[model samples]
Target: MNATHTTFAQDNGLRNIPAVDDFSGMINHPNPLIRESSPLLGFTVRVKTLLDPPEDKKLIDLIEQDIRHILLRLEAERYEPGILISWSYFFCTFIDEMVMARPWGIECWAQHTLLVRFHSETWGGEKCYQLINRLLLEPSRYHDLLEFIHLCLCLGFQGRYRMTAQYQEERERILRLIHQKLQSVRAQQPAERTALLSNTVIHVGSTERERRYRLHGLLSVKKIAWMMAFIALAGFLLFNWQLHIQTENIIDRLDVLLP
Candidate 1:
């Protein structure tokens, strides 16, 4: 079976027929210039088309193209660079195995600058996995998945895309495993492993500076406090000792025990 057939067969009787079919009709209308009279109908139609596709390759192609074009055009103006990068990274690197925030492959456009889209269906929690899984089930669409994963991971969480010490450690640990897998592959080049290690080290180095500086600052503060406490105790003891010697001399003289 072709990609469309496979997709349709898998979704057969599994999705809401009315909703899927309704959405399909709205999206499949011939005239591109005409506005969808009913926004609700348009959304349902789009959803239905994806849920229920005919076996026609051209139809499937058109549907895919339309969905992508519409979504991109709708989202392009948002321009969230951090989310875009983070979404791109996740979409590319991770697999949608556990229904968690796994990567779905997708790419970034340089000028777009935005790292992510804010739609719930796209990157809003668990729904993103459903979208990703649906896309991967169809052939010739893995590239989009790759791009999404890369941007998502690279962007990390929000505008704070740069790796912190903890995050850098985690990334290195993941890369270490990837490198191990690469090594196990037959005929893999030595340079590949070296490059992976180098990248991991570089990432760690980038974030280490901040962690080290904070640690050093903390230690310095502790050291200063400890020094002050020790000086205070020493002064107290010295003063007490000198007073005791003077008191003893005065007592001997008063008692006339030592003249």
Candidate 2:
């Protein structure tokens, strides 16, 4: 959690932002508690970046292949495939590595290329690890934030992250732009509307097993009552049969004594 800030002006091809006073000083992995774990390196790989894409693709591809392979291996142990296939911020470091290491490396490349699309775009390099940690520290709807960040990275790279508002009032403005674009598109196109509505409905619908689970409890109550009633009736019939057998035995004994 150790951090120090130093300011920077745009020099060469670098963006106008702060730089780490000393990256090595800021990053302390040699702490007595820390281990030389590759997963930790994998975590570092997410926040770490190269100056350019072409030169770095080789390493990036290796990281992605590792992530994908691990994901597949984990999949066999899990009942749900989408859990590993989907997103979570806790694994952002791993995810970031996977994205960069993939064939397209679209997500990683976009973070470098598309950050300008958002209002609080900071190209803080590995220092971004601290920033992401800060933003996601508290308990909140983090999955949504991850989705938003993912969208920002992709859109920003495409140069679609535009300055639609005055400084400091920018994020809300971009959201409005997004909504407007979708609204207009939906209004103009029927196919898009149908697809959107269908997807929404499908998402809302309950799964068959969930429906069966809910119904099973109610069905069990009736079954228990029926079983209890049958047991009571059998007990009543057995009592009468035992009484009649005793009476017949007594009558035979009395006849034999009178004879």
Candidate 3:
């Protein structure tokens, strides 16, 4: 059987959908111009159609293009806040689809969305915050949640995005979840520990360990330096006392001889 036949069989007799690249070309076709009459509805139709088939090769690229198209329409329509919120929710659904279809590409799609749409000056923080909350609440979209938090951290560290109190709280909560997951994995499979530790979620914990190690080393060095200083002072005092005693004895001998 050919690759296409295998992909179709994987879908269990559902309509044989074209690959994402082919579908993307269809969406980008100039003829019927993705009807702006109801952009959200049209976009939803496209998303559902593409997701109907189980095979998701190049899915992330197609979603990125879809988001770009939506953003362009929003810009042309002059920032309708309501429509933008709808778009945010729509993208959140994409996270669920990604989690269900293929787990690995979720991170790439999430990072792309953050850098392209959420980080855009045109997109409001309120909308971004709402979307993030939605992702966090979903139990299965942990990868997306973690990647979003990571992107936020990267942006905040670069001074591109401000880290607000709410964002900080979210970060802490996600880190706690990650630590718990890491511990669970370690308890279950000792051999898998190394691989799990390499995940992005473990970064915060590793950084804390490194910081504590440096602090411990600094304290140890300070203690050693203090001991060395104390020993040097004592030796200097003892030497001075011994020299004084020898000088006094010589002076007494000189006096007696002169008499």
Residues 40-151 of candidate 2: C-alpha lDDT, one tens digit per residue: 2223333334334433444444444444444444445442433342222223333343345445566445554222322234332343334334434421323223322323
Per-residue lDDT of 164 in model 1:
44
Q: For each candidate, give its TM-score against the true structure.
A: 0.20, 0.23, 0.24
How many clashing pairs in candidate 3? 0
Q: What is the lDDT of every predicted structure here?
A: 0.32, 0.34, 0.39
lDDT of 3 by residue, 168-248 (tens): 545545445544443333334434223322322212122342222110111234575898999999999999999999999
Model 1 C-alpha lDDT per residue in residues 1-259, reported as the tens digit of each score: 0113223323433234334222233232222211121122232233323423333434323323443443454345353453343343343222111112212112111212112322222233344434444444431323223222322332232212132444555454433333333333311323322222121111112234322211011123457589889999999999999999999999989889655
RMSD of 1: 21.6
Error of 1 at 71 (Å): 14
Q: Which residue ranges in model 3 land beyond 4 Å of their true spot?
A: 1-121, 142-145, 154-259
Error of 3 at 57 (Å): 34
Off by over 4 Å in 2: 1-49, 52-57, 77-79, 88-259
Give the Å error, residue 71, model 2: 1.1
Q: What is the TM-score of candidate 3?
A: 0.24
Sort by lDDT, best first: what order?
A: 3, 2, 1
